[model samples]
Target: MNQPHQPSRRILLKSAAATTAALAVGTAAAPALAAPGDTATAAAAPGGFPDYRYVKTLLKPSQLTYNPTGEIIFPCIRGTAGRLSAPLGRYYLYYAPHDAPGGICLAYGDHIEGPFTEYPRNPLVANVWQPHYSVSHVSSPHVMWNESAKEMWLYFHGENTTTRLARSKDGITFTYDKVVLSTSMLPAGTTETSYARVFPYELPSKNAHFVMLFMLNNTTNHRDIHWGWSADGRNWTFDQKALVSHNDVSAVNIGGPHLLTRGGSAFVVYNKDKTSGGDLMITEVGADFTLRRHLGRFYESAAGAPDNGRSASPSFGTEGGVPYMVYESGERLQGSISVARG
Candidate 1:
């Protein structure tokens, strides 16, 4: 992800009663920040889970068949092909180059370890949607399949302040939905809201079927993680507070949150910019929107890894039950898609 114009830029709760109350109204005030040198209430947990071992560069900007000039960053994978339209392939790899005119692009392969082909026309979605709206660029593509609607849900952002949604039955042609998230929903000092990922989760309310986690840039110019809840996957409501902050992990900035469930407990796997080679960190969230503990670094690149001593923006997947992570490996704004498995 790029430096937010020099500006800015999830898990279950443990308390059942608190979770129920928060879910009922679709909002929860984040717990107060801990004092300096403290990480909420507990020490950093040791070791990362799924223990990602470096794989290979899945896609590089220079390797793209079309518009291969810029960097390629965020990666989201869906196992099944589109239901209402012809299959693009058995698997769809959604990614985008986080540069000006950052286009939401697509590529496909028969296997997770892809000898993938980019969409011939390229840039499935662009910054300008004509009559709807326009911006300098649009990037950070995260995709999910809506089973009931039989459509693909694409979430992305532009101009930093807004995160928009679009739906496509064919997974190729999309119709603009709405701006599901913006900085206005967050606290007063929030400057930007972007990099959102939506997942199906069991919240306590009957109307809510999904949860969203994203980055929030504050007045201090430090980035933190914030979240929202959704009913029917289209409409959303947010918490006025942050889910995780730079102070929570003693980092200058923190972002890129992906939900990971292990042993029936939910944890958020994210990256923090405290080191030159940014390390992926994990934290446990409770039933009341309370951040429980700061899990320590899981994956930090060695001196010569393809991540080039830098890694950020991770999305997880499994091939035959073997877990893996696809992440931005290279320099921050200028990166390539690299993979790792354990």
Candidate 2:
């Protein structure tokens, strides 16, 4: 397989610096316009929000058994594992295995922090021609159990340009459903759509129950998180306004959205491109689903750790009343998965 393009260190640093400068200014003020239909009247808490720090490395690329030779695979650099807790105190982790035979793979463990065992039948979803008739090089699997559908739903992107959906009775095997959102669904000038986070959210006013936060890539190549709502897990209606944008956070690029709710309040966590390093930033989600306030950086690369330079692609879950985050760190392909808690 051909090597995926890697940005030079100089370019990466320059981009990070630009993002830092923009963040310095962008986050200083509140957004002038609220998301359409947002009716939030409450101000954000003045401080004392839960701050998360890196705990330890969870899984590295070398640990995946997809490659018999144990070589680090391309595109499988940083992990995007969608974690789910099952009965009997077991857990399932679904992720794209960026090996020679690239596809989505699964791992099982008895604990959240685990010596996870890769499923014997790996590559649960293969890099085959998709329903859209494009050669599929898929990654970034975000799995959720849709109580409404009574089955597991796997949302993923292929080639980092199209977002598609699939369903499974069990978490391991899946069947393609349809393209929920993609560039073709966007306005004429838009370039791509990817990195989707779908979760069950109760919209008290609209009487809806599901929300999607996804990255939108414009013609200029800037990425931002946009909001969408669904009554069921399938069909959706997107708001043109972004939940988080370059103007709001001084980020040239932003994506990797994850939502966590605790004690009747919701929090949105996402990655922002930065000069020091790309890190996760968070904000409160109001009852109306509009982002309430910027809570600043949620997690950054540890000072001298293997992931010290960059971190991105955050996934959140709770087990035993403890909140845990799984994310990718370091450069793509060389990056690994790390977990943290509040």
TM-score of each: 0.83, 0.76
Q: In candidate 1, which residue ranges exceed 4 Å CA deviation? A: 1-48, 81-85, 205-207, 274-277
lDDT of 2 by residue, 177-254 (tens): 988887766666677687787888888666678888888988887888887888887888887867877667778888
The per-residue C-alpha lDDT of model 2 at residue 38 equals 37
lDDT of 1 by residue, 28-47 (tens): 01211122343222222232
lDDT values for all models: 0.71, 0.61
Query: Candidate 1 versus the native: TM-score?
Result: 0.83
lDDT of 1 at 18: 48
Residue 90 C-alpha lDDT in model 1: 60
* lDDT: worst 10-residue window of model 2: 1-10
TM-score between model 2 and native: 0.76
Please list all clashing residue pairs in model 1, or write none if there are none: 12-286, 13-286, 13-287, 14-286, 14-287
